[model samples]
Target: MNIENYYNIDAQGQIVSFTREQASSFAKGIAGDFNPIHDEDHRRFCVPGDLLFSVFLAHYGVSQRMKFEFSGMVVDSTQLIFPAQLSSHMSLSDANEKNYMDIEVSGDNSKEAEFISMLSEKYVQFSSKTFPHILVPLMEQEKVMINPSRPLVIYKSMEITLDKLSGKQIELSLKEASLTNKGKKGEVRLEFAILSAGEEIGHGAKNLLLSGLREYDASQLDDVIATYTQRKSEFLAVA
Candidate 1:
């Protein structure tokens, strides 16, 4: 797949505009993210955070140690511009300069096209599976659930530190996952390790914010999972 097409970046490698169609396609096609908020017709539709991360990597390249912090949501047809030049730190903003995400890079960096693409694909596939596979179990264990009506889960931030990176393919495995709740809001930390040839090469953590949370009901949670699974199956079958 031509990753650039998913983000609607131009020939100059700048994201002039993003649309709901593009965001929806990227969420389902690239990340397997079936969240309703990513739906084109959803009232509260927002671009997938993973899509933004993929665009950043496609433009700025990947680094040995990197940090990404999300500040605002990108709505449909929002006009955005990638930094003209990359620095150790950069912020993605709109035409009016409203910041959406802050990115920081340190340590070794790689500009190899193949390596960046491989890493991007591997990491995103891993990150996208956080929902039912990881978050569901975690939420069940914590006895809390995101509000069944709204179900707002925000991608907060992520950080990665690597000893070294090589090879054409990488595999990610969860090292640890924890959820902390304070009243109605909760924070989830998913710690993961990157491996190649069955040897660890790097580690990272993805943080998510869960809002409007309430006490979990076993039947309600089961229903949610069932819905999610059916949606995923339908998507896969269509693909």
Candidate 2:
């Protein structure tokens, strides 16, 4: 996926803005995420959080170990302002310093486009499947589910640990998908392994925060899944 098509950067090398179309297209084209909130014409037209994660890695270089904590969502209209460099701990914010994400990095780094592209594509394809392929089973096992009308699943954090940053083409496989909840809040952790040429190279976890949880309702969830699948089908058919 050519992530450069998803956002704009000024001549000064700072990311400037994301158009609704750009964000929506990236969500579908690369991440295979058809969430309506990412629809160009949706009322809540926000850029996919995974897009931010991808842009950060593309620009700053991927480290052997990294963690990203998202604090807020990014609307298409928000012009992002970034730090001059990627330090040990960096917070990405808007012009008014409205922090949206915090990043922490350590270990060796690679700026090679081939490796970065492979990693970005592999990681996002896995992360984007959290909805049904991964989350549904976890929710069923836990006997808890998010609100069907206002499903608010937040990208709390994601971390990756790589044994080394060298790989011709990357592969990511889900090692486990688990959920731990208390009261109305739940955290879903999707642990995955990174491999190259069928050999394990590293691992990572994508953490999601689900709020307004309640006892799982099979009927309600089935309806929700039907809606999601219908939207995805319609979008793809048109595209």
- Quick one: best lDDT, which candidate? 2
What are the candidates' C-alpha RMSDs? 1.5, 1.2
Q: Write the per-residue lDDT of candidate 2 for residues 98-191, one digit (tens) a residue.
A: 9999999999888988888889988888888888888888889889999999988888999999997878668899998889988799988888
Residue clash pairs of candidate 1: none
Task: Give all TM-scores, in the order shown.
Answer: 0.94, 0.96
lDDT of 1 by residue, 111-158 (tens): 767767777777888998998899988898999998766778889999
lDDT of 2: 0.88
Q: Each candidate's lDDT (Cα)?
A: 0.84, 0.88
Clashing pairs in 2: none
lDDT of 1 at 4: 71
Candidate 1 global Cα RMSD: 1.5
